[model samples]
Target: MARASSPKRKPSRRPWRRRLILALKILGVIAALGVIALAVTVYTTRAQLPSFDQLKSSPNGQMIRVHAADGTVIVSLGPSYGEWLSYDEIPKVMRDATVSVEDRRFRSHIGIDPIGVLRSVKLMIANWGTDRRIQGASTITQQVARTIFLSNKYTLSRKAHEAILALALERKFSKDQILELYMNKVYYGGGAYGIDAASRKFFGHSAKQLSLGEAAVIAGLVKAPSHYSPTADAEAAIGRAGVVLQLMAETGAITPEQAADTDPKSVALAPEPHQNSVRYFTDWALPQLDMLIDETNAPLDVWTTLDLSMQRAADTAIKADVPKGVQGALVSIDRDGAVRAMVGGKDYVSSIYNRATTAVRQPGSSWKLFVYLAALEAGYKPDDMVVDEPVTIQGWSPRNDSGHFSGAMKIRTALAYSVNTIAAKLGQDVGFHTVADMARRFGITTPIDTTPAMVLGTSEVHLIDMTRAFASVANKGIAVTPYGITKVTANGVTIYQHEVDRSHVLVAPYVAAEMTDLLQTAVATGTGRAAQIGRPVAGKTGTTTSNKDGWFLGFSSGLTTGVWMGRDDAKRVGGLSGGHAPARAWHDYMIKAVAGRPVEQFDTQVTLPEWQLEPDEESYFGQPDNGMFVDENGYPIAPGTYPGDTPTGPPPQQGYPDAYPGGTYPPDGSRTAPPEQPPVQQPPERLDQDWMDRVLGRTPDPDRRAAPAPARTPPPNDRSRGP
Candidate 1:
């Protein structure tokens, strides 16, 4: 307290004045040092600045690009879109709109606009405490500096560099040259880097051909390419164009009448092209792009495995068949798994979901192929009979489409008829897990649940995977991995190439032939009958319960195709069955898809000689709970087979003997019939023992001399009705 009293009287005002003087000196030195530093920076930049020639050489640099298989430019993945255009090539309206909106005093300003910078500072202060760019203080020249020379930062040093560079650019190049560089270098929407690319992308015309409306739209995109892209969102683009038109008119760049008329003007967008089918294939291959780049970093000329003609066919077929709200996907893979054609959806612009490769849905009866293939592997034959009566497993009872049983039917008949009860019974005979393994072996990567419902197609899978599995059958059981890229080259030098890869045979040749025969029966008469293309085709039609989804999976000797139709929302399509739309659409598409090509039939023999064999008694009945038996032909009996004839029991079950499509006379010919039983009741078409003896090439009895190997004609409806 005593020191405070002394300080109050003696605390020198001199010390305060001296401190103020010292602070002023420090500030003066700082201002001088800042001016000197700025002058040095300006001198250094001017000495090292890139010349106009250097910039002109690379006015439109870009990264890699993508091309269609036919050498047409599909789309550019690079930073730049199309070729560079000179100022003369750029439309006047486009230039006017840009000047009016981006820099009103660009023509009169030396390098920087004082008023503009002041307004930008005011805007920044208004939006203080944030780093957001409220408004750019750069003039057109400053924009060029920021685009080509300086970093995109809001700090004072960065702004100083930008201003220095702009002055240097003005000293080195004419205003027209600077405008040309800006026009050719600015980024537009959809990978378009310049006015030229933006013009073509939005109007399907070059920059020189841009109309007032198109020019205004492109000018508006300068603020934000993606946000103002007409192709992405037309309403936003149109609104931006209106603002540009108003700016142009207010700045005396155009009359008010012109602004009114141009504001009302709408963009005349080009129609969606047919070649866009390549998008689906390219979208799939994009993931592999990064791994393909070499040390040169040059754009690769990648050749794909797409058949544009077939792709168009697939697209046309889907668009023609699918209803308004329903979506459909189609995949056509060659026997080698080359994805020749893929229609991921009815319209890709509406959705890029890629249903062919990504969307997984239940296949319904289409999954029976693997189930029946598993049955064949488990030693069940096409001719073996299974009771068509309903049965249950794990509290799951599946009924045939027709609730009434056909009593007893052959495995071939059951498959051709799509009898659900028999298929479920066969799955039980061959474990459901075995069925899943069969699918995996066939290149179905999607997970398969092993359960009673698996045979009924409860498992979900992508259409491409299903097509790949079916392609294995078409290619004689060799599992194929679907691939699109064939070769990648640059500067006429081959860099990356893909070799044909196929997995070991997962299905035996004989088993494949048998499966093909059964699937052929489906196309011949059953649910897939609509897929017939007047040629030998094999496939299955699948309609899920409640008709939520439909599928038609089919294959020729050369190509395998799968079609799927459903609502994206998973709502039921009510009356649309696989046979009605999917099969018919497949038939229509396949007819044209396979046209101008030779008709190559299946690898299997179509005649009976290949399948017919000598009957053996040991293969005659069921193998207990296994649900499979051997026929007289020494082959496993049908998946539908049961213990119909016990050999020593009462005359074989009444309807059993007639089920045989062969030449035997008695159902229990190897064993004597019991005394109480009457002669076996047989169909009228049943062959007598004397005729069977002749058909077996046996010598005729003296009392009833028979003809030579008798012509054993199966029932006329056998192909459609099953063996």
Candidate 2:
């Protein structure tokens, strides 16, 4: 024992004590160096910091007024604050909730918190590759530094700068002033910036009037504005508000019992996303606000191309005329594609879904506009024959809307009458792919099925695009981009001006004129007769097979209008045809909308090329692929027999396969034809006389040898001309 005690050697000279002293000295050196570095950072930041007096002239989010073409205000968009408030205007609850949630211990921190900085550093080290700041440790003063005094850079230098500036700010200003700046500078979601705008936008009042629940919910948005926005995502926002309330309670800003009693879901909100005029248009124009302001805070004016009078007309037309429980949309565009008027629905507040430019539905027969345009381009003339007879193509037999065949007539006549058979036949002749191409070339941005049904408008399209297409026709073949804004200005200085576009020319004047001529007849005497306005009008009526949708697309020289009527759920609108309510609505809106405007007419049509020659007579069944044969008079001969000629075999079905098991053409859409085979065993003298009379346009007299009327062609069944 004596030997072991002697070996203790003075307790090893208190090794732990010596190590403690050395460690304390190292800590003292680090602390002294850190204090010196921090003082230097503070001094440098103070020199670079902004003046507190600058707060009075600090930039505030602006309120913008959208003006119609007539200089009348359409809506006041954006931060609709009457005036910016000082820190005193913000309520204590609002401030307490913001400080508790956004930055707890905000009052105690000098610019930056060492504890917060340590926590933030730990999070950054743990999340190696992520941009996520697991915990935002920037004090309220630091946020103000970034917003007012420094750049929002995510770097060590930026953070150091932020901390120094924050310290300088705390030195120069009181806690309330810092809180005031933070409250007014933070973005609160929707287009709101600052507590005043956010308060007015969310709670319909100023920040001073906010309730505990409202303050908590609003404060939660400071983390991620759009994500936690009470008006945008109520569920997420309410949950975040509950967290804020709990934090506030834990911090002694509010009682634990009060926190437990407050239901975040009980927060009152402003009416769900509403506006004075069309919500769609206003919402669509929102992004333009940022593009125009460019850091200015003065009141700005946005002049749009909309014609308020016409907009009102469209709204009135939809509200007064659209059938009960059914929706309606109307869009009016000028030749320049200016959206003069647009009504997405009868009531925007009831349903904000816009049908005019967003909803897509089958266009029905109104699609024939493109089909006829194709046919005309392919050397078809208005006087060209389109026998309104029941004809089948590829097991798809088409007929007139009346289900009765109106024998051979001109293309103009067929169009005027809305004869489906002729449209289908012509579509096959010109080719369905051709029609689809022509439609896209004009203004139809919708997908087009290259099947035969497309000629009947089976594809879905929006009213605005369809109206835009018709507007193209009115504009003499030049395509126009639909635009809303004309000019944006502040203090009489133009901020933004729409560029004039001279591209997208799609059709030729001659082609458009021919189409116009044909469609004009459609309005005058055909299915579109109900759409006839006082002046020259061209339009087409559209009705789907099951009455699922109806449309009236028309144009005057000065304006073009499109109307759609249907149920939103795809239920059949029984007995509803385009010529019914849609046509009348179009007529009513267009007539008044264009009142007092100079009556304009489509450009004078240039001379059309002479009709192309048909296939040569020497050609056989497999002859040239130029469609059909032309007679000596330059008219295209229907595909069948001719006098003194014998068909070698069935001529390959020219356009589409003969849809019928076996159907024949009399070379002219008539049942009677000149002899091709041996004279049918002794043609009855009376029969021969009746045939000759019918061919010569003389009704056979009863007094003359009476013969039974030629067998009438049967009406096609549902499968023959299917819906």
Candidate 3:
């Protein structure tokens, strides 16, 4: 026993090896427990997750984005989403900025970055119980999952859910697809849900139009939208954007010189509109969706013909001039019939009704365009003499707004002054049916009766239609079909394309030119002078009975614009006339609308008739003389008959020349009050053919008839001279 104890006395020196083995065993058990926990988390999250297809397809998130022809955003319905741009369609700068700022390892990661997660964990642990906030390290894939499927709540459960879905998405889609999805769904503050919307909301343009600074600014909003929003604090947003640019430079997304050359502060933010009048355009355009595309759950991108600059100009002009409680509408069209700008009402939020496309009102003297067109077609010249005396047609005696006629005057002067009696005579000479036919041919879809009052625009017509008719005249006889939607695309695939057959001629070129000459004279020296833009303008002024509606429709610089101001309830507006408020609005809008455009001259050669060249010394020309020198027969009297009258003072510009002596330039009201007037002719009551049915591309129902419009009654006083 002594010998055995002596051998056991030698103890082992490698005690460290036993400790190492124990450590290995503990690590292996811990690893097993971690693996089990991860498996459980994935299993639970997977169970609660929706299918990949379900997550990708946003059925209720249908957005109809209406864009201007220049790719400006007019408005969007439902969620504010940009077009779903593919990876290639997205600008490289936008992609690089987003990737470099949001996730550094986006390209190398497989849905989740292990190093990033570990770093985030280390940061969280180091900052625990401190004032420093914990930062997240979500890869782009994880973000896509959260944006498309998960809630925004910050919780361990949500993190687990996002991670599981991210891994699943990686397996299901390529990296590029994942990135595209993320870019299209990521929130960029200010109600914008994508790069496109953010670009437009902040820069007044599209995603494709984004500059390097703009791209960086948008990318910086990913961290905290409310914090980095440019609209909130531009300096802070620029600082964040500068940081993003630096990140991009470090990542080699952009060169150091490029970063140095970029100025984050140079980015201009789009001015916020006082009221969203563009909603009127979207409201008018959204109904066309059902007719353009097949039923689909995918979001739609509707490219329209709107000109955002012109729309802004119109909104500004209308708001500045239109009196409160009264509404105004405007429509501008290109020569090709593309609707550039549409302002349906002064304020869209107060009233959802669209006066431009839906509300039908009397056009007043503007309707005389058709009557004169018919007369011109009947071989009547502008210089042809027409008597502007009181006329009766079947117990209805139509009188001028001046209550007294100017006797005989040239037809052009008659139209320029909007002489109701002269218009009635022209209607009688051309036959009322012929005038009605002319109106129909010029895009007047409302039912026009073959009566004398029809010559004065007694029938109700949509503002858009009258605008289109005037546009047709400006187009030099080619019929113009006002269209807003140019095309529609869903999921980057074009589902509908607008096609136009522009070969149809509505009138002879010569006739159109003659009409243009007449309209030009009206704008140059007649009632529409208020709408002059120091360029070649051709238009007419219209004022309804009791000044219920004021209208100015004109064209210049290859653009045709029409303006109307009135109350929604059809109540009278005192002193409101086409030459005053409406013409002023048109002038303000057109001056801005045509600012950058080159001046264009009309192709007209006036052929003054023999009678026009050798006028009588005492002949009248519609210029009001206050009856100082003549009776109602336009005859000259002796000198000193009226206040400060001198018979030697060139006998005055005789006849009704748009203005009355000591009276307003544009005579206030026109047309006789209808003996049995009906309420403002409402749109057809048929469910299938609602008011919008008359929009572009719709075939008006042949049998559809408006209520029989009665003849207008002249006002009692002479001061209310027709414009």
Candidate 4:
């Protein structure tokens, strides 16, 4: 009966209606709380942020650019800027492409695009449920705010800061000004920070000169620079540009026909200097800046010792010669140890490991330089007789690069031929301790074991260090600590200047001359003939066992260069030897490097005793019956004939009769004769201790010497067996 009565009354609807109204009130309160929270976040973020003017004129955004000796920009560190372009100067295609790809709703947004945020939320939900991808919804203004004012960290506070700054920027600047700032502050890869620099770096032109396709390619790089770098991976960059083109068409920025007509592949990238190989030098030099001055945000002008022309030459030579699966590195330094040119690897884009400065590989026969130097210091003259027969030291037997060894030969001849047994004997006689000391004195900072095999270059060494050692010899026995930065300037004010610092002489001048004599013979007719450059050249050739490493260390015309070729994984390269590839590369590089410079001569050639063969020894060594004897000066003379006596035979014939050239003999046997005496050319003006400062356009300051950064040491197991 009560139920019937209630049904008749139809249960007044007020209670349920009241419940609905209360629920609505609660929902409204929650929405109001959200709004208050967002307002507080914005206020707090704005309170901590830099003012718009501060962000616009920040010095922290400045870059460090390294210039070569001729004032050519070789590499840039930090953010690189080009001339700021006005809004009108930016190509319309570039603006449209960037907007289409970066933020389709950029024009309609008021600092933050609500519709875009909602769409992004929807897509994110869809992605979570259906495993689909979602694009980011950060508007261009938000990006500008983030880049200029906030860190890239993905925190709620950072997001709040980005939004607050973006809103503030919109209120303070017109839309065109905002866009101009965005374009001028955004980063495009390869060290480029602005649209103008990006255009110049990738397309070799100005932003105002971009075509539709080129603009699209550059716009696409904003998402990922290394992945889509045109100079790094052209195919990937072109594909990314195609996607940008499709987006342009979809956004009505370009017609479908126009997008289809533009081929991304048609975009030609700028030709980089030495394929940007100078990055190795910059990477090595940038770290030293911390030691020179206090940490600074202002832009720095780093005048380096690099020669752009020589760098190009080294890069070209390495690219034209290094075989596949093999990597090559070269380091060239002036007599004062200023690094002029450096090629770390065959292609820097493929590998960034700096072989010239960091990699430590075996010097093979080149290591013998220290051993022979030790012997020279131990009162052994170049003309002293040294037997090349089989010898053993400490149960380690060393073999000649050539299977056969001559019974007896002059010490210079033994070194020129790179006879391993003779080097081992010399190391034993002079003491490996002395050999190691000699190496250390010549800028070889790497640890050396006193083992017998160390004399044959079994110990590892860096190309830069070996080049520095040879540079000391070329500098007439003065020690050389290789340096790159000549001067550093910040905000147009001088901060640091490199001091001419060669305070120690590693060896006596006479000893260096004697070593130079042996090295000259090696290049003139022995193992290193392939390195000859029609001028007095001195160097040593090195080939590791199984052809795992090949090296050539030499100097000519006041430039000392060292070259190394090997696999990074220590795998063997077939048919690779120092005399063949490394020597040839050294020759090619030196020929171009010394061009137009006065063909300088080494110090007065040291005279050595002549080799007088026994009556039966010439035939015993398989010499021809009419064979000629080589006088003390390396000129061929009739048997039993002395110097200054006319030979009763055909004009000085080619080829050595008894002692053969070291390492691999030329297949053609054309290098049998000594290097032709080059017409003497005037030498460059003699340089004093302050010569480097003069060349670098700074006054000498002997009192202020900045200690160079410590040399990197390789692991103890980095040794390679010598041939």
TM-score leader: 2
Clashing residue pairs in candidate 4 (N, C-alpha, C atoms within 3 angstroms): none
* TM-score, prediction 2: 0.61
Candidate 4, after superposition: displacement of residue 167 in Å? 25
lDDT of 3 at 164: 83
Q: Total clashing residue pairs per candidate?
A: 10, 1, 15, 0
Query: On residues 15-62, what C-alpha lDDT tens digit does candidate 2 reach at each position?
Result: 899999999999999999999998887777677656666764576556
In model 2, the runs with Cα more than 4 Å from the true position are 1-47, 51-57, 82-182, 189-191, 205-266, 270-275, 278-282, 285-298, 387-401, 404-407, 428-431, 602-723
Worst 10-residue lDDT window, candidate 1: 618-627
Residue 212 shift from truth in candidate 1, angstroms:
22
Candidates in order, TM-scores: namely 0.55, 0.61, 0.52, 0.55
Clashes of 2: 1
Per-residue lDDT for 87-147 in model 3, tens only?
Answer: 8989999999999998889888878899989999999998889988566689999999888
For model 1, the stretches where C-alpha displacement exceeds 4 angstroms are: 1-189, 194-275, 293-296, 605-723
Q: Total backbone clashes of model 1?
A: 10
* lDDT, candidate 4, 133-187, per-residue tens: 5657788999988777665656668777777777766666677777888888888
